[model samples]
Target chain A: MSLESVVAQSHVIVCCGSGGVGKTTTAAVIALHAALQGRKTVVVTIDPARRLADALGLDGLTNEPAQIPGLPEGSGEMWAMMLDTKATFDGLVRRYAADSNQTEQILENSFYRNISTSLSGTQEYMASEKLYELAIESDYDLVVVDTPPTRNALDFLEAPRRLAKFLDHRIYKVLMLPTRGIVKAVNVAAQTLLRSISKVVGTEVIADAIAFFGAFEGMEQGFKERAAEVDSLLSQPDTAFILIASPHADTMAEAQFFAARLRELKITVRALIINRMQPSFGDNHSPEDLAERYAGTPLGEQYQCLAEAQHLARGEQKHLLGLAQELAPAPVVQVPVQAFEVSNMATLQMLGQAMFDTDVTSEP
Target chain B: MDPKQFLTTSGVIIVAGKGGVGKTAVSAALAMASSSVGLRTLIVEVEGKSGLASLFNSAQFSYSEIQLVEPSLGVGEVRARTVLPEDALLDYLKDHGLKRISGRLVSTGALDVVATAVPGISDILVLGKIKQLERSREFDLIIVDAPAAGHAITFLRSASGLEDAVKVGPINSQAKDVLALLNDPTRCRVLLVTSPEETPVNELIETAYSLEDEVGVSLGPVVVNGVLPELPGLQANPLEAAAQAGVELQPSEAQNLADAALFRLQRTALQRAQLDRMAQELPLPQLLLPYVFTSELGPDGLAQLSNGLLAKIRDLPDPSRS
Candidate 1:
């Protein structure tokens, strides 16, 4: 199916790509198109561009989706939300906690307070958790996700599994026992492990950790089950993944890697959207010929400009051909580099038109 | 300080930026520029996937330092190595002569525990290794290719955060030493990298302020990579300009030429506007590297970029004067 169909029909669309490749912009454009097609849509971004936030009329930090003002006429409705990782983590704690006291225990624990934000997997995992919350709990027709900008974008997919692994680790189990005051189960090896860790990080860290784990008790099953549900939700027919990329070799490489990884995970990339591609000059003539034809004149310099621009465009096309070959049969949409930054709603609409090869933006 | 002093002023120059902004490439250029001035430079790569080794025409760097550029007449050497928390922890254990515990630590997966249980332990481990390298003075300059901007803030601040979190232990002392090195301008400084684009420029301003107000890391010149070069005769119409130049162009040719000309002109204008805003919002010396349009993005491209960076570095005003 076409990318427009993905926007029209899918319940969830995940935009995965590296940073500085306009991944967030692509997500926004897609969401805008979905709204223009009269489908209720919400685009969630980890860090919203200041201008985008302004255009959305978002005054400050918002925990829920806010309706986008002044969408092109006939657009169903568009909403934007800024993902607050900390607030989402706290929500999980409240959801899984057996009682509010358990919830307070986890929230008030200094170690949890410190690691909940800085935790290696927490940021990525929290993004998925938020996605699950919006997809399963919200009423929007489509949920567009701009995945967090991690060096390895696959971290978002593997994060739940990694956290689950940590939860089930024997060492983690050992740490939990001490908080429960199970002296009988603390083997000599476990004792040595605790002492060794304390020698390196001091006893207070160990104490804080035990307390945090104790507070986390009875919450693991709920988290594990939710993770399983999210995992299933991702691979379901209702969900779609679009891989965003650029002409730069580094980004192209990242895109290829992401596609391959998704394949390993049994997820198919619906479409490949390459943003910021140089507009082709369509000059088939060689630079040698152009120079001879327009030598020693102002026109020669102008022709040189054309030649240089064409050279870059040709090179990018070559690189993208390899990407296309690697990702064979996946429809590739090439969007020219924007003349201005996509900081406003007008430019965003123009980009959406360019992606779909349509001119519905004529009214503006 | 002059360019040489601007570079040698601090033993450690941590290069960081948003991913896909050529953070790793900037790190390579800085190393090449430093070595050009007869300074022995070593680059510490934290992201094993950084492809920094390839920039120097070498294989992937492991824990063992690989000499990428050998010393020559009037030029120093360039060497690099990758530092993971696992390797650094093993080295730390071996340094203290606890070799047996080291093997068991890995075998029992206690290292992962240490990293998870102690927030920022991995970053501190990596930074601690850089500290050790700085103390040895084996290299006149050390450039760390730090993580991307988002993680970079947390990475650089890890030591200080841990210092406050853990008050008395080996981890605490390590945190203190790393924080000291970061805070001392003469010992280390951070160089924020960015492209002349809106989102990156905005992020750079925020990152620069965060590093100063939060991490207390000394800031150096902002290396603005990927600046588009000014196209000649941008204002003149291609058809009109050709007619004036005593040359006639076909309609299609003129169209293609105008398309390219407009593209280049708009890009250069945007570059200027973004740089102007950056100057107003964040007043740091800017080192402009032209946007690369090369088909060959290997050693040759890296050399060209390095030369441009070195030229810009030489033009920076003396910090003491500021």
Candidate 2:
């Protein structure tokens, strides 16, 4: 019902939207608001844009929590970190391995490193794992996450299950099966095929892969089960998924898709923050008059340009208003796009206030 | 254009970088440039952002490409990935007579199960479509206003990966065609757009190396947009520093002092330092664009940016000419 209410109950707050729509800023603002309300908060961002650090006034931050400066200096603190997907994956393997030797074997494997860094769903898995770790650590009352601009935005939703399945698949079990003795014709045939493949590829990468999988024999089910639990934690109602989008048709469409997906996954989308929205002045004569006056001059041409922007702003506002009307169950907050970028904390706070206006959704 | 010089078999020019770094803007510009040279070009935007629509001042551009600059350039917004997902590809396939039977195949845990079981199934479909567009003989170049850096790298790499995973059928052959286009340096050029920011710079460098190593596609160059102009008279020297200290600055000299102070020399210096770091870290030559303080980038403004780009292009030997 209220921003505070959601903050108090929600363990995981996932930010979803198209790129350049200020989803990261919304996540940071929500995290800041929670911390300000006497709840320990950590905003974890996977956006490659690095906007959270800028919004929080940090030069840069690593994967671990870095305490932010000048946050009113109180009992409830705010910390931020950028998710380094590769590092997190490496850390997980290192932690879960049977021994240091096993860990080294996996790390040195080409397949593992490639899958950890460049794979599509890997970041989403890492993000979920990171959130699960944060939830387990209980250092913070809430963890706000900014997801990467994915194709379906479902990867964030599907990540835990996907990883769990990948770890627990029959292929995984087959790969991990120890080859203590190989008297069978099938083993000999496979070995010959592997040798031919190695010669063609100019590397023994397959052998390296098999060795890495061998080290994970006893640890497979543990990782899979952990992934399943993490997935449950994410889909629970306590983990609020906040959908952020602009007022543009494209952004609104994205919001719709995300909303439907969230509904399917049974994740409660408690609120929607429409960022960079154009505020409606209600019967403003400035745009028309200005456009007419500057009709001939370059400044007039400039006004012509501003006219579309003004119109789009008005349209977006109307669209958001329509969305709020359509999705009446969920509270939608509209933060008008400023003339300049929302780069500073002062501006972010202002936006937070605009977005969480008490008048919009009265607290229960 | 010399075919021998063309590094790529298909000219699939993908414009990608960090959001707000003007990837769409550069994509439109590159499309216009290619089309103006009499090469038929189609610029496809998957997210339906319609940044290209706004640039072209069109009311609406749909899945059906609308001609922007008659006989040459065109732009269109396909179904945004979020809305359709695999359905977008399904629609494309259905239009090509692949049919609902195929959809049923994908859903029944038979075709779908097999596809899903394959390591890079989605990559095959998503990239197979884009690669098909690239290979279309109707256009000389297909400019894709791709997703931002994180996803774009994965999208580009999908071609070769699918080729390896689907090593035997028509899909594998299609993957080979796409891979040939992508791996050929001349036919396909990957342009990265950035605004002289640290994160974008670092990401761009990371993307360049990743593409080079993983996919064998050389990153063209870094297009540094929104660079500040050097105002000679307003330059901060020892004289200006002394003036700021209140000794050299008088009422008569106040204009220059205020001017120097207000122009954000410190921020500009820091931005330049970041740019310098980019030049050092990235092997690709950088194209620096002058910053426009104006609210909107209209046609004239875009033309100015394009002119600056053209001059930069002239300095480098045209691969086609070479």
Candidate 3:
């Protein structure tokens, strides 16, 4: 159940977890490992924090994948990129629009500008689309995706569908139909309601919405088809999900929920990564025995603290063991908390080694 | 201004930080501290994560305010509630007599489009609801456990964004009101929480700057949570101390002790460096909450954190008196 095996078997690997769980780092290291093992890999991350670039020893990353600079020459290649949601949306508009004029109209529309860039789920949707595009069209042997830090991990899976549904709804088309003809066709009550809404939300917002929808009129089919492709790409057997979490109760609960939800979506979760676990000092001596053994020594209190640390580590292990039981049959890997921050290649390499050093099926 | 005075005077306090940094716990502790000082405190959470309920050991919290801690000599009076954006939208629709269509819109996913398609509209609604509650004066203090850092900035800027988007309307007027409240330093305070780590600390600094520059909201105090306590005299070496004490230790026991002390010392050093960097960069009042050893942050754990926070607040100079 090594990460290497998972990488070898799956063409697409999606790393998902709540925030601050080192998900980006995990994804990067996995990609790095895969690339070093002679599989051309690209890690696409959505973290605006730019930790991926830092991890990959790059000054910065854009929407396009840039080759990582520092790795010793290996058989396979490694490239990393950050998802620019706004740029990706703009690109999609250009790709789907009938002509440059239509693309310009859609891009300039105020509603489209707001929703495409700053909307909550737009980034998730675009990330999925980008991942699907890379998986299907790009030349990489493996594609690793670091998902958005949404409260519910399932939002990543639902975002594209939500966008497609919004686009395919009848209201957009009805609102955007030629003004006079639509008014004549609709009932008086509905027209009056529309007038009131325009007045309430401002005519400018309504006009912007109408123009955006009108410009997007012919592009709905393309968007829907792409959404379906991304959906299938995620659910297909070639894709695998890796759920990352820390040993904290709240995070573990989230991981468990995400695993169950992914299962419900019919996506296979190949592995669970428990990051930043406190290393156990072994069960040879209890804190009480240590305290008794070091009585009247200056190191007594220090020994007591050590015992407490051991106890905490054991407690964390017990909690993780419980989680393992809950996620039975899904292999679990544990990464111990490093003394130093992971800002350099050495630390990342060390982390990768430590991460896979254990047998994934064994109790951590 | 002093942290204590800021807490005493501000009618609304918003706690924000990155995820897993104990923002909810800090918010709950702040609520407890405020209530203990005789303020009729109301803590609100918008994520609908039930973090507050679990922390308070309550069954559940709905959209309505419920009494979490009744007025007592020691604990004082505190109430908790949750505000979901969807429910807020429904309430807004109900106020406008469009309640009948609200359910259909939500069911068909049209409501989500309208809420999200308009920049800052959803956040404006959430803040608008909080503003209404503040205006009602039902509580002496209101604490909102806002979303994580990146989105929290968006939440705080909703007022300004709305004002910029809508020129003349009820929404515009309401946004103006919220903006006034937020811009008024005396009425609102923003507290940033972070665990003593590199990533969270970096995020705290960035978010603090954004809160000031983008949202025009001045930060009150930075709360650094889950800080590990440093063991005395173990900074240099623990093995030397054991050897100096003439204690014969087994190889495994010695190895364990060294490993434990090494982790503690290393973590303490890291925390100190990050805290120092934060102080140097941010130049704001900061408070540190010790790491609670408990596996679960239940009521007792929260109480311990509350006491630590209250002590820190009390230590601050009272600007009003001066």
Candidate 4:
């Protein structure tokens, strides 16, 4: 099946690859294509560059879904949002807190303030949370996500499970105990752990962490349960992981690694979109053919540059061909290295058309 | 600036940029440029994914340094190793004489807790290690291939963020020292790399502003990587050129070459426009790295880039001893 078919069937499209692989633009392009096909779509991006917003014809994106302007009038609609990790974490806090006071207690805690915004997996967890929210609550037929630019591919995939485990941690349970109730005999294992951490990070930081977990007592269950939901939703059959990769060896290795990781999670890459591939032009006459055809022409002088260019293209394809074969059954869509990037609606739409019009096939 | 001037004056040059912008490759090339001039260089890889070891075909370097690219004729040397947060924290504990606690921190899974519960601990640990390296005066130049742009901001600001969070303790004092190293222009400078594209240039500008305003780190010349090389006579008709050279081309051959030429011309124009915008927007001296037209930037491609870097650095004005 082509990417168009994947877009038609999948409810959640997770665009993931290494950073600077044009993951955001590819996500936006897929979402736009979905919308044009009369499927109401929402694209949730994490910290989009200004040009992505410009391509979507918006001043900028926000935490809340803002309808994208200037799409061709159609039955389907398009909305875009940039995930604010802290805001999403705060919303989760508010949703789970027993009352306003408890909410304030948890939110005001210094440790919560630090981890909600700066904790390694906070963005990934919140992005997944937002995706679940849009998938179930919103009326959109499809929800496409632009994962955070995390170098570790495992971070986005592991965030929900990691959070759930954190909520269920023995250290967390030990920290949740009242400050006055920490007797010597109580939680000897956890006490020893805390003593070790305190020596290195200082006891004041531990006290803050204890207070942080103390305030988060009643809300842990909600968070753990929600994280569980996200973990399952991610592996659902209707969810597609569209991997966007460039032709370089590094990014190709990254994409291959990503695909292998997804396989471990039982999620196959729905479509492998190889972006910015230099076409070999071997589809036309070979340089040998050209040389033979025009032995005495001025074009013979130009063979060096053209042949060099062709060699470069062949090198790119060599890497991509391996990626395509490994990610079998996923439609391999090759978007040629364009003369221009997607800057405006016209070009964006042009890209959307080009995505499907190009070679969208799968040998597997 | 001469290659010597550029290599010797800089203490720790942190090469950072958005992912896929050839930041790692730039870091490797910078190390090559230094070692070529008989400068002992150490390239510190953070997060452990920069592919630094692969460029040299060396084995994966751990927390400790290993000889990566051996010098030719005893003139140059490049050693590389990784500095991760967890490993740095472990070393940090040992350095502070908490060797006993270090073992428990790992066995009890408290390392993750300490790193996560206390904000900026992870980053500070890594920076503190870098600070230690600088203090050792081990290398003529220390090139830290820092994280991509978004995390690069947090990474640089982590010391200040820690100082704000913890007013007293070893962590706070450690942050103070790291901040000292970061703020001192002579000690450390951030060399930002970016492609000649809209998004990368945009991210680099914002990261530069944050590094200056929030982190107070000195900025070096912005490296415009992947700049398209211009070719003469790109606009001329391929058929006419072919005819002029006393050879004729089939229509299809002419068409294929024409299409490739047009794409090249347009890419050059677009790159030139973006490069101009960058000069006006970010008022910093820029060193342009030509786009290597190879498939993979292996040792050969990196050699070319390394040579180009030295040539560009020489054209720059010598740094004043501030």
Lowest-lDDT window of 10 residues in candidate 3 chain B?
Answer: B1-10
Error of 4 at A115 (Å): 1.3
lDDT of 1 by residue, B1-322 (tens): 3557778989999999987678888999899888888899999988767668767778779998989889998688999998976788667755654565777777766666666667888888899999999999999999999988888998998998889878886888899999999999999999999999888898899999999999999998899988887756656787898888777778887888778788788888898999999999998989999777753368878988999998887787766777
Q: Model 1: DockQ against the native?
A: 0.56
Q: Where does model 1 exceed 4 Å of error?
A: A175-186, A288-297, A358-364, B1-3, B93-109, B318-322
After superposing candidate 4, which stretches have Cα over 4 Å from the reference?
Answer: A175-189, A192-196, A282-305, A359-364, B72-74, B318-322
lDDT of model 3, residue B127? 86
Cα miss at A356, model 2 (Å)?
3.1
lDDT of 4 at A342: 79
Question: What CAPRI grade goes to candidate 2?
Answer: incorrect
Off by over 4 Å in 2: A48-51, A54-59, A73-75, A98-101, A172-203, A284-290, A297-306, A340-347, A358-364, B1-12, B20-38, B42-139, B151-188, B193-322
Query: Across residues B85-185, which tens digit of lDDT does each residue of candidate 2 receive?
Result: 25444554454444534544354222222223333444555556666666566666777787777767777787777677545655566678767777777
Docking class of 3: medium
Residue-by-residue lDDT tens digits, candidate 1, A1-364: 4667666668999999887778777888888888988989988887877877765566753768888888767778988888888888899889888888998888888777765665667778887888899999989899998898877889889888777665545665775566667884555676676676667666776777767776776678888898899899999887988888888776787788888889998898877888887877786677546655776665776777777777788888888877777666666788888787776677778788888883222111
Q: Clashes in model 1: which pairs?
A: none
How does chain A of every candidate compare to the true chain A by TM-score? Answer: 0.92, 0.84, 0.92, 0.90
User: What TM-score does model 2 score on chain A?
Assistant: 0.84
After TM-score superposition, the amount by which residue B125's alpha carbon in candidate 2 deviates from its true location, in angstroms, is 13
Order the candidates by lDDT, highest first. Answer: 4, 1, 3, 2
Using alpha carbons, what is the TM-score of model 3? 0.94
- TM-scores for every candidate against the unseen true structure: 0.93, 0.65, 0.94, 0.94
